[model samples]
Target: MTGILRLLTARRGAGRLHWTDWATYAYLGLAVLLMFGPVLWLVLSSFKTPAALLEFPPSFLPMTQKEVRVEGYPQPLPLFSVTMEDGSTRELAQVRRVGLIAQMVDPKAPGTTVRVAADKRQPVREMAFAVSNYTEPLAKYDFLRFLENSLFVTLIATAITLVINSMAAYALSIYEFKGKTLAMLAVIGTLMIPITIVLVPVYLVVTEMGLVNSLWAVILPGAATPTGVFLLRQYMLTIPRDLIEAARMDKASEWRIYARIVMPLSAPALAVLTIFSIMWRWNDFLWPLAVLTKSEVQTLQIGLNAFQGELQTQWHYLLAMTVVTLTPVAIVFAFLQRFIATGIANTGMK
Candidate 1:
């Protein structure tokens, strides 16, 4: 009992943190803000009107100008309060047909209206929500078509990627072959070569294959990636050889073992690869831009390019479409993120 009390007291003495720990926490807080601040701004800005978006000294929260329609006004006029030369204030009533003259009313008197120049009117603006920014783009632009194309390409490409990469990783990890080392080296070698260096050749091949202007041109070329194979192979190596030998002792076919044993055990790795593949295929711009020339078949990223005119950009629509583009990837990450954490932790330990 005396020894236990001494050990507890020592732990209590060491539990108190110094200034460095607090400083580290503060730094991490700032880093997190810096990372997510723009994303928060993008989401908020998607709900703002064009006029509100262009306001000087930009607002982080979405807002719109306040307006009211009076008895004789044909359109809604901006609401304002007028302060007269006599230091009396009146609520906005209406504007005159002539010059910048605005009519004002008194809250105390129901039937009272007064005339004031536009200079004397202090405009009032209130927080306004603009949901049309999201809806209008989908209605005016063929955003639905672009969204469909993006989904089709992302899903198909990711599925193919998982199948092909997993098979390759399985072969390299489990099966003994004469040239297995060379094959693994070849896969790793491709990673050192930048995609930009092969862009022209890839485009030409797609052109010769008659895949240009088609979604297949985008999907086929990226169906298999070296990084996916490497990731899955490394994770698969951590699985014990005893399991595979035991399955073989049971007379399980190689394909059966791969499908039933390997796949289920590698769920964490597959989840990680699924997220990576989805992000790549969904956000891919250059390859899709090079191959898909038809407006009807263009991906969301390419379709978003249409908003940028030579002189002016439709920022409201651009921001809204950007939010739309990011939604699916965000959702996929949300669901599969735990798997990713588990996979990385296990892989690192291995």
Candidate 2:
């Protein structure tokens, strides 16, 4: 209890910035909720029933049809008086409506399985749950195929990015040569050019290279990222020149020095780049869409769009799939968070 209190007090202390700090923290919290509240609501709605989902007074925890069915036992069923076609009132024994089923179920049997009669006149509208809404999307669309393709592209691209970025950064930071200034300028210059500006030319090149509809279309283009190279170069510059000199004195080859010394010393920076590369490649949508034309080759983000068609969108299954998709990124972030923090601390200044 004291530990909890201490933690709360610490949080409160951190939140306070004189008198203005409280207001700043309050504003930040509100801004965060404003951005994420809708997303939270969408995720919550996935668990709700169809009727409750579209209900006016939004249900917090909508009841399911399964709740009504207890094996060989029935609760005192509520009397919903329905007017018959003959204009006479009749109590429904078990009409099997949405969010409702009439059955004599056993409540006392602890482990007994309950059975509900089907193949009768089942009402389709006003379903008690979002089961169909969720399952249909996975079955109807090639969602799993898309997930596999997305993983393939992201893993390959991340691997390529790591190799290319590390080598280029080593060259720029450690090796002095002609056009080095021009090379740095060129890399930095790309920051000014929006990717959209080169889309047409890039498309033409990819099409000519016969790489369209292949994972290479996504992987190859993403490998030479200027941001990755630039970030790595700055970190590499922090490596002490003495280490390289010592390595040379030992008669070590350049490759040996880089492999044994530079690589070992660059752990924190590599961790930072690994996290960034994973997120960028995993959640990437636009370029993958432009390059890959085959339905089988589409990534998760594009596959998500395919789930949203002209007429209908399955919010429930889509939200569930999103949760599944985001799990990996969350896991990676949680594991590598310390390394990322260290990288930020060392950026440029170190």
lDDT by candidate, in order shown? 0.87, 0.72
Off by over 4 Å in 1: 1-28, 93-120, 348-350
Q: Residue 297 lDDT in model 2?
A: 88
lDDT of 1 at 59: 91
How does model 1 score by TM-score? 0.87
The digit string of per-residue lDDT tens for model 1 on 201-311 reads: 999999999999999999999888998898889889999999999999999999999999999999999999999999999999999998988999999999999999999
Give the runs in model 2 whose Cα sits over 4 Å from its true position.
Answer: 1-6, 9-40, 60-136
Deviation of model 2 at 334, angstroms = 1.2
Against the true structure, what is each candidate's TM-score?
Answer: 0.87, 0.73
How does model 1 fare in lDDT? 0.87
Q: Which pairs clash inside model 2?
A: 17-21, 71-105, 71-106, 72-105, 72-106, 73-105, 73-106, 73-107
Model 2 over residues 1-350: C-alpha lDDT tens digits? 69756533444354444555566667867998999887677666676755555666565554443333333335533223344445664332342344443332233443533233333223222335456655666677867888888788778888889888989989999999999989999998998999899888988989999999988988887788888888888888888998898989989999998788887888888888888898998898889989887898888888777657789875666676786578688788888887887776775633
